[model samples]
Target: MNVRHQIKDYIEAQPELKRSDMQELHGIILGIMPDCKLWFLDGRDESGKVVSNPNIGYGVQALKYADGKTREFYQIGMSANTTGISVYIMGIKDKKYLAEKYGKRIGQASVTGYCIKFRALRNIDVDILVDAMRYGVEKTRV
Candidate 1:
């Protein structure tokens, strides 16, 4: 199936509370980036071994590795975990920025370098989350 369909299926497969939360986040992120590219990663390698939770990604950025190789990846990504959800803001240079800038203001979430993780949507300040996401998208733009 298509990427959007895959993302929908993944969100729908969550538990009732998580399902609604995921759906809300999906909508909010789309509202922030209406025309951005969409992505779905099933959290497996080419060999199909599960390495992580499934992820739904939005926007795009070309990343350069330490070896000078580059690869295209999403600017913002979200995933479901056992305890809660994770929102990843890729391509930030400073590892402490998110935590220092948004950790306290973002309510109950864990604001890391590239990830904002929380147990539920109602537990966090989504406006600050939106600000963080917008910063990520704008910062990583080509």
Candidate 2:
């Protein structure tokens, strides 16, 4: 099955959700920022070359922020083992600023260079996340 179909099937199998749940979630994310471009990433694990399991079902958005530059906003793979979803803001230099501002609310914050991991989507503050995404986009602009 294709990545989109797999995602749909996986989400549908969950007990608490209706067919519209995943679509609604996707809509909510896009509604927060209409300019974001969504993408699906599919790849094979290097070590599994002999018996490769093509990993898929990752979602991302490339958005342009106020300063007129674009950056990648990614949510890691979807899986039952995942306690919650993650959104990553990468290539950030001002980790301290973001951590000081949103650390407590974003759930398990970590920073390396410009990469900021917002570990649990359900616990994240959407407004803050939007600001952070905008900030990253602005900061990276040349």
Candidate 3:
């Protein structure tokens, strides 16, 4: 019932290949952010509808909405999707930074403003992914 347990269970519940990949990513993210806060989001809204895939998150960032509402969220987040995985690097001001700086070097991943999505870990460069994550965490510090 704890956040760590929830995150572990989520990763273990993935398909064989994705399970291993998720576990690997979990470990790598923890290694990069040793002692950082950990988070598990079941992808539900206030009404409990499943709006998105569950995510295992690392670090901390306070998100301010247009209505002046604020929510505390993770700086780096990972999730398993139908095709593969998504790693979200949140709070970057420039929407094109990730794509411009790491799109090609990151291999087959899709580098959006704050997300790097790929079919598998082998399809991308792990080092570059780590760099992007580090940047996100540092930039989004509260």
Number of the top-ranking candidate, with lDDT as the measure: 1
In candidate 3 the C-alpha lDDT for residue 12 amounts to: 88
Candidate 3 regions exceeding 4 Å error are none
Give Cα-based local distance difference scores for all models: 0.95, 0.48, 0.92
**Pairs that clash in candidate 3:** none
Steric clash count of candidate 2: 2
Better of 2 and 3 by lDDT: 3
Candidate 2, residue 62: Cα displacement in angstroms equals 11
Root mean square deviation (Cα) for candidate 1: 0.7
For model 2, what is the alpha-carbon lDDT of residue 114?
Answer: 39
Alpha-carbon deviation at 139 in model 3, angstroms: 0.5
- Local error of candidate 3 at residue 61 (angstroms): 1.3
Per-residue lDDT over 1-142 for candidate 3, one digit per residue giving the tens place of the 0 to 100 score: 9999999899989999999998999899899889999999999988999999999889988898889998988899999999999999988989999999999899998889999999999999999999999888889988
Q: Per-residue lDDT for 30-119 in model 1, tens only?
A: 999999999999999999999989999999999889999999999999999999999999999999999999999999998888999999
Worst 10 residues of 1 by lDDT: 104-113
Alpha-carbon shift of residue 78 in model 3 (angstroms): 0.4
User: Which sections of candidate 1 miss by over 4 Å?
Assistant: none
TM-score of 3: 0.96
